[model samples]
Target: MTEILDTAVDFRATMGRLATGVSVITTRSGSTPVGMTASAVSALSLAPLQLLVCIGNHLYTRTAIAEHGRFAVNVLGEDGEALARNFAASKADKFAGVETVDDHGVPVLKDAIAAVVCDVAEALPGGDHTIFVGAVRHCTHRVDCRPLLHFAGGFGALRTPRHA
Candidate 1:
């Protein structure tokens, strides 16, 4: 029989088969912005409008986001790979030359597929990561482009619709 640990390992390895939307989880302390490249964001609630973003609990970004309480999730479109890289680096100057603005005093990236401003409502311990439950405070969208996606540890392009 497969042990519990072995089953969990297999499940995690197979999780890559499930594609997910890519996003950058961002926060600011004064004028300085901090962020992380995350493919782990997911919507959790609709009535109160909540979202969950998984973050490695040991990273600086986790602490920063916790301290800030207010943060934004920037939905990067297919062409925004560069932005993703910039934000994912450790304590890197992610804002250098990046087109962004303080959305109602919260850091929001410009030209995102969509930007969601939220406040940290709850934090739960998820196995290797922390699941941040944030309450949506504001949102903006541009329907012209499709969202960036990730699968099997690589970037993915949007699928085209088929003709009937």
Candidate 2:
């Protein structure tokens, strides 16, 4: 037997069960940096080293990435929940008080678990969001950092089960 769920809330609740790594998608508008917290990021290809990020159509980061044709994905560490919340808020200055360094022309979080710079390859419309597919230009990672994760509408960390 199969059951059907026909509501947005049900869809969101079902989707939220799938845990995801958190990342800040950063881009520059002129000389100023803009970014947003995102979990809808994924590697699309390996032959050309490509990745895709889904950005809200109205987000400033989306516009900046479109104009600049470049972006950086900063994968947050386990301790970066504050940073994630800051970027996720609706504010004029999301970068205020945040520590960052310029990577080429994009801003990358200094303490993130990993960062990947990319040049936009394509932009596809997906309902209220735009999917930006990027070709990898540069990437850096820290082996010792634990990734921040999101699931069931909350941030969490991965824990290994203890063997008795």
Candidate 3:
């Protein structure tokens, strides 16, 4: 007989093995800017130029995105690990000393490797998280930057393997 190991801890551990690019999902709540570090972001479609981000239902940023109907995905570079850790926390002021600029009415990290401003197209429930589908309105990138990555519960930079 085969045994099925299905537990929250096990699920988390299993999923943590998958490496993903790090990004900060930013939006505005009223006049205040809000953001959260998210690895659950992904490009959803090409035709409509859409992307999706899964935000926790309890996150204030999630509520902000829904209310404002806009958000920006700031793709972090290698030097953004500290910023990522800060945003991941439940800090009252994540942007205290962080430099940002307004892009499409959303707060975008100035040092981001890339930024994608989007309008909320649809929001769906995903267990305890809200899956937000964004229609990309504007996008920008810095070719010189290398992306930061998250893997096995830690942060890292992408490394190309040397050919033999």
Candidate 4:
């Protein structure tokens, strides 16, 4: 008998089956608005309030958060897929047509399912990415919007069945 680990693609596909929420990680430095879409956010605590966002070394956001010392996780809804795609792409005008406001003087897209403004408490090296642990400063949420969910590298809505 032999055991074999699946390839990265296959493993990634398998993990994609586990639905996860999508968020736009936003920050600003100097006079530029910097943001990127990420699904790697995870709530790490409650007693002291904490969460983590993974930033790739090559992305503009990696530099922005480090310089600005603060960030906001703008949780999107199912209808925000286009915005997510816009923020995730490599372009010079990601925010040109986006409707966002200065949050505590920092840019935050409007109508997010939820938004968490946090200060970068620490940044730790995590393999090929940097794990930014933040201490929440302020938070807000939409009254009745379901958050955007992602799975298998695609957008999805959980098949939530209504109770009888």
Candidates' lDDT values, in order? 0.84, 0.94, 0.94, 0.88
In the range 1-164, model 4's lDDT, one tens digit per residue, is 15555887777777788888999999997888899999999998897999999999888899999999999999998788998899999998788988898887578889588999999999999877899999998888886567778977888765555659
Global Cα RMSD, each model: 2.9, 2.4, 2.3, 2.5
Which window of 10 residues has the lowest lDDT sum in candidate 4? 1-10
Say which candidate scores most in lDDT.
3
Tens-place lDDT digits, model 1, residues 49-140: 99989999988788888888888999999998778877777656878887888885577888689999999999899987888999999988
Backbone Cα, N, C clashes tallied per candidate: 0, 0, 0, 1
Per-candidate TM equals 0.87, 0.94, 0.94, 0.90
Report residue 77 deviation for candidate 1 (angstroms): 0.6
The parts of candidate 1 lying over 4 Å away from their true place are 1-12, 162-164
- Candidate 2 segments exceeding 4 Å error: 1-3, 160-164
Enumerate residue pairs that collide in model 3.
Answer: none
lDDT of 3 by residue, 1-164 (tens): 25565999888978998999999999999899999999999999999999999999998999999999999999999989999998999879999999999999999999899999999999999999999999999999998678999999999998764559
By summed lDDT, the worst window of 10 consecutive residues in model 1 runs over 1-10
- Tell me the tens digit of each residue's lDDT in model 2 across 2-85: 678779898888899999999999999999999999999999999999999999898888999999999999999889999999
Between candidates 1 and 3, name the one with more favorable TM-score: 3
lDDT for model 4 comes to 0.88
Assess candidate 1 and give its TM-score to the true structure: 0.87
> What shift in Å separates residue 161 of candidate 3 from its native position after superposition?
7.0
The count of backbone overlaps in candidate 2 is 0
Considering TM-score, where higher is better, how would the candidates rank from best to worst?
3, 2, 4, 1
Name the 10 consecutive residues with the lowest summed lDDT in model 2: 1-10
